[model samples]
Target: MSKELEKQGWVKRTTIDEPRLSEIVSEYKSLGYEVHLEPVHLEDVDAQCKKCYENQSDKIKTVYVRKRKQA
Candidate 1:
């Protein structure tokens, strides 16, 4: 599992994996960066990809992950 944040107008990237993802989010938030996370299902993969591309192009960063769905 991994999480990435794309800041507005930044071409470079920062990647974080499980355990670290949570830590990074907290760190970024403490630094005053707005952060969000959404559970992504396999069925919604395409939509999620599109969203990441569009939003990221506009300076919004996103993290992609394949997590087991909760029962």
Candidate 2:
């Protein structure tokens, strides 16, 4: 007999505020789903950069979410 393949799925999110993120994550948890947060940081940010590298190191913060374990 041949084996059957199972399908999988998940949710992805873009940059969001802390309170909203928490509310969404809590909802997912209540639904018995797994939540994953990915932090994205970039250097040499145009806005955050300083006059000289010695003065400051630029960085950008962003977040992504992934929800899994759905029926």
Candidate 3:
């Protein structure tokens, strides 16, 4: 019984959003398997992400989801 609570053996780990994680865990459990969730510390988030800088375009102005940018 105590062995069930032990954190040992293989696990699949990924940083997914909460909603998606819940969906995946629930889906797995529905198929009848124990799901173990553990937090992973992502300590090295890039402060100067060059990819982000490259992908971001100049901000576009819009209004009412179709109108125009406000002055």
Candidate 4:
């Protein structure tokens, strides 16, 4: 999975020890998309984005922009 991302210049095949992150990468690869897992701190505002993405909710399905400042 990581190899495919590297091939597409989306991400480098470096050591990723996190199991969940690796799983996400593998899933995206299986779907034929080049993706790199972006590290997110749970305490930050982007954590909400991560949660929304995980839940697959329609509320967050529309175009949403993340603010630079953490709320």
Candidate 5:
């Protein structure tokens, strides 16, 4: 997580496979959270999964969510 995001109260949720990203994002929004997505970097991948990610065309992303402030 970046310092800026943390300062703004964003919390790391989970890394989701590309196919399910939209579904999870919608779920978070429906529950009143603001969603942020960042691409999963090679360094962040586990040793066993690194090869899989590199060989596949699909992407993985880290999800961040922050509660919406009351108006």
Candidate 6:
């Protein structure tokens, strides 16, 4: 899915906590971008970072954004 998104021009932005997710999403939308969010996946994390997200994955999200195609 990540590869598919990248192929479609969606750039991975950041993985963030839910607390600031809405604010960031709104910012991207306001800037005319199409934003997509996915729950953090185990494979998405580095071995060292996996521990931190193992139990908190549900509280975090992976952010991807792409410019809206002009009609």
In terms of lDDT, which candidate is stronger, 1 or 2? 1
lDDT of 3 by residue, 1-71 (tens): 12343344324533344456677666766655556654332232244543343343222111111112246
Which ten-residue region of model 3 has the weakest summed lDDT? 59-68
- What is the alpha-carbon lDDT for the whole of candidate 4? 0.41
Give candidate 5's whole-model lDDT: 0.84
Regions more than 4 Å wrong, model 1: 1-13, 36-71
Pairs with steric clashes in candidate 2: none
Candidate 1 per-residue lDDT over residues 1-71, each given as its tens digit: 23243333222224334566677667766665555554433343466565554433433234432222346
Whose lDDT is greatest here? 6
Least accurate 10 contiguous residues by lDDT in model 6: 1-10
Greater-lDDT candidate between 3 and 5:
5
Write candidate 4's Cα lDDT for 4-60 as tens digits: 534555543332334555565566566565554443233333564566454433222
**Root-mean-square deviation (CA) per prediction:** 13.9, 10.1, 18.9, 14.9, 1.9, 1.5
Q: Estimate the TM-score of every prediction.
A: 0.33, 0.41, 0.41, 0.31, 0.81, 0.85
Top TM-score hit: 6
User: Can you tell me which runs of candidate 5 are displaced by over 4 Å?
Assistant: 56-58
Ranking by TM-score: 6, 5, 3, 2, 1, 4
Candidate 2 per-residue lDDT, tens place, 1-71, comes to 00121122334444344567677667867866666554432242244332333342222123333445447
| Residues 1-71, model 6: lDDT tens digits | 47898899999898888669999999999999999998988896899888888889889899999998899
- lDDT tens readout by residue for model 5, 1-71: 78898999999998767669899999999999999998876677789878776765257778999998899
Residue 62 error, candidate 1, Å: 5.6
